[model samples]
Target: MRKNSIKNTRVNVEVQHELANLIREGIKDPRIHPMTSVTAVEVAPDLKTCRAYISVMGNEEAKNNTIVGLKSAEGYIRRQLAKNINLRNTPEIRFILDESIEYGVAMSKLIDEVTGKEEVQEDGENNQ
Candidate 1:
């Protein structure tokens, strides 16, 4: 079996990083919550549209508010992105809540709890 390289994935990652930084330092939307971070960017093969995944580290209200804020400023963001990225056509912006990072943290906690169980004395030899 051959190990495949994730060239496209790497490209997407780079784009995500740049986009995240751009959003953090460039746009200052009043609706945007203070704790928002761009988590991922999914660009289509044609690169016509890019889904920007955002993560907000706050309560449900804060999360919803941040997304609403971003949605309202889509046009401004698209323009800013166009100024930054050189492309034939600027990709349409779509803001999506990325819960994967939050989910991963939760999963890690659960896994730790489960693995800690293994340290307990089940029988005696099994504990070792």
Candidate 2:
């Protein structure tokens, strides 16, 4: 299949959704935080490997632990996924920590602070 074919896109989306559900309800590992979520999924064209992007809402330690826990449970998760979805081959799943959300939030806060300062300066000038 072509790398960017419609079939590949559909498979990627399906895998992402199923993986998120499995992590959310199937896995009971304590290391995986409740705030964990599947942010994205990239599957190889041959369906041999998949990179699952996960986001955790907590400190660095929690995020590391969540990735570790997911790595340990990769096999089981793949098996469950295969059973749920009729895929010819179950891809080797790799969990990755995604910090885009955190980065976006930080950027937004910085913008707000800058805009707030500009507003304050304008108010002062108006009052002067």
Candidate 3:
């Protein structure tokens, strides 16, 4: 099957959703932060491998620990995945730390700072 085919897209979405659910409620590892989220999932067309992008809302240590926890739980996650979703072959999950959400938040803060400074300047000028 083609990588971007409809079937592949559906598989990706389903895997992503199930992964998020599993991480949020199935796992009991303390290393995995409660603020963790599955940002995206990419399953190979052959359904032999998968990349799960995970985002954690905390320090570097928390992110690292979350990945480690997820990696250790791969087998269990896969089994759960197979039971939950009827796929031809349950993909082997590779946990990847995704910093896009953090980056976006930082960028937003910078923008707000810049805009706030401009607003302050405008207000000061108006008061003169």
Candidate 4:
């Protein structure tokens, strides 16, 4: 099968959606923060494994704890997916902490700071 075949793409989207809902409404792990979200999922071409990218909105400790919780619940999650999804074999899922959101937020804040400084400099120059 092609790397980006239509079947693989559909599977990826469906798995991502189901997993997001499961995390949002079904999980009861305390280590998982309330702001955790399934940002993306990449399913293998062979459909044997899935890499779930999760974004946790919290400090480093909270993120680590959330990963731990997810890892521990991987089996249960897979079984739940098997029951909910129509896939032949529910792929083994691995949770990865995605920090892109945090990085983007940091970049935005930095940009804002730079712009504020530039505005201050412009005002000072105009008043001179």
Candidate 5:
């Protein structure tokens, strides 16, 4: 199958949904933060491997610990995926720490600061 086939897209979405559920409810590890979420899932066309991007809403320590916990529980997660989805081969999940969300938030804050300063300067010029 092609890399960007319709079937592949469906598989990616299904895997992402299942992974989010598994991480949120199936795993009992304390290191996995409650605010953790599956940001994206990319399944190989051959279905031999998968990359699961995870986002954690916490400190650096929490993000690191969450990735470690997920990596340790990969086997169980793969087994669960096999049982839940009728895929030809259960992909080996590689947990990836995604900082895109945090980066976006930081960028937003910077924009606001810049805009705020511009507005203040405009007001000062008008007053002068």
Candidate 6:
């Protein structure tokens, strides 16, 4: 088992993919929003702990609600995965709010603002 990169780690990748699919298709929790996505799942090589980073496409309150929903269903999720996946022990599941989406959205907005300002200035100079 080479702990090189995410691609090489089959256990981690497979488990994450299976779990994400399970949550997306199987679980029916009302608190979970429709646009929730599993951004990434990181599991220890020993299959001890699994951290699932999720992103909700909405405001802060919506994100918080989604996290709460996931936390409530964590046990059920783990149990289901254990029954489904062939493993000696199912890794513990921890749901975490992924901030990369938020960061990227903010960065893009900043870039757009700067570019818009530049365009306006260029047009003004041309007209003068």
Cα lDDT of model 4 by residue, 29-128, tens digit: 9988889899989999888999999999988999999999989988888988999999877899989999998999999999999999999999999999
The order of the candidates by lDDT, greatest first, is 5, 3, 2, 4, 6, 1
TM-score of each: 0.77, 0.96, 0.93, 0.93, 0.96, 0.86
- The total number of steric clashes, by the backbone 3 Å criterion, in model 5 comes to 0
In model 6, what are the clashing residue pairs, if there are any? none
lDDT of 2 by residue, 1-128 (tens): 45478988899999999999999999999999999999999999889999999999999999999999999998899999999988889999989899999999999999999999999999999999
Query: Could you tell me the lDDT of residue 13 within candidate 5?
Result: 98
Output the number of the lDDT-best candidate.
5
Error of 5 at 80 (Å): 0.6
Misplaced by over 4 Å in model 6 are 1-8
Clashes of 6: 0
Residue by residue across 83-118, what tens digits does model 1's lDDT show? Answer: 776666777878899888889999999999987776
Question: What's model 2's TM-score?
Answer: 0.96
- Candidate 2: residue 119 Cα off by (Å): 0.4
Report lDDT per candidate: 0.77, 0.94, 0.95, 0.91, 0.96, 0.84
For model 3, the stretches where C-alpha displacement exceeds 4 angstroms are 1-3
Residue 27 CA displacement from its true place in model 5, Å? 0.4
Error of 3 at 125 (Å): 2.5
Cα RMSD (angstroms) for every candidate in the order listed: 4.4, 1.6, 1.8, 1.7, 1.6, 2.5
